[model samples]
Target: MKSWSVVTDHREWHQGDLALPSDPRAWYQLGAVGGWQVVVADTPRTVAHDIVTARTTGRAGQTAAWCSLPFAVPVLCTLATGTGVAALQTAVKAASAEGLPLHRAVVALTVIGEGRLPPLVRAAATMLQSQVSAVVTVPFDPHIRAHGLAQAERLGRRTAETGASLATAVLSAAHRAWGDPLPPASVPAAVSAPAHAVV
Candidate 1:
């Protein structure tokens, strides 16, 4: 994501115009007021290992093949497939420790956890969730309570909002005894309690 300028309205979203790059890969760019990097791993062990190495080395972590793109002390965006929120929690701790101020650690736990969604919508779910989460949870640079809800209002297309399509992406385990590839779909509509539930 180049610079998440400020999502003015939903009209801009459907148009995929928000002062951001049109590159679809930009959709995978997730994080805070500044910028962030995606840390995708197949296992929690690997994820934890990578996080640790990054923390100790004071360098951003990347997959064996990926080149770490550190954008101004970027926050970490994690997507792991092996287990629970333990790894995510670790990220939160790391960010907090490093004074990220507004770091995020989200994941699609299990597909079964999120009822179900059609394939295409299911696929779009993660992208939307990441965008929404990062936008809503901004830097304490401003009063969090004051600016939080407004962020959602501006990006939610309804400035161009996609309802159920914006639900959490839950997954069980991809390469497990009882697993699939990733989560089903749907992001958390509300930061705390949602006004309407998504399936």
Candidate 2:
């Protein structure tokens, strides 16, 4: 799988108009802003490894392939399958460890098979549950039947916004998880009070 940029444009709330080259690795062109472009070299590992790993283990991969992207920019994390929830989790963990804060990054996982979407979304929510700012899942597989290219185009378009949103939300959640002042909205609802609770 080779990487290439796909031509596009980014409109940020604060950064104003920006041009994204029609190349996949042009993600960095986003610079230190709230928007960008991400064209992933499709691969099965996205579904095979990331999803299975995250679901099985309580963590994900933090290798070079996953970490090379400019975390500072809103990232469009594309996969051949919508199964890289673990990668996303690993990213959050890495950000926390690096003291970078999750709210500063936006992450989107695109899966080719519509059937696999539900599980992927669930896994992401699981990762984000303990923090504020709900995780967003933009499903485009359903749009494949009518227009396959159209679906891909939509995926590219949504990546910009979702990337920005995820960045902000994750950063917020990361701070809350780490005991900062920011409240984490993504935290799962608490169940069963402590036994030591006063009667």
Q: How would you encode candidate 1's per-residue C-alpha lDDT over 48-114 as one tens digit per residue?
A: 4655687789776542212222212122333332232345555455544544422222333222222
Which ten-residue region of model 1 has the weakest summed lDDT?
Answer: 169-178
lDDT of 2 by residue, 1-199 (tens): 7345554333333555454343323433332132322323322233234434654676643222333443322333544243456666665664555444344344555555445456556666666645314545655545444444533555455555655676556556445444565332232234696678567
**Best candidate (score: lDDT):** 2
RMSD of 1: 20.3
lDDT of 1 at 72: 20
Residue 97's lDDT within candidate 2 is: 57
True-structure RMSD, every candidate: 20.3, 18.4
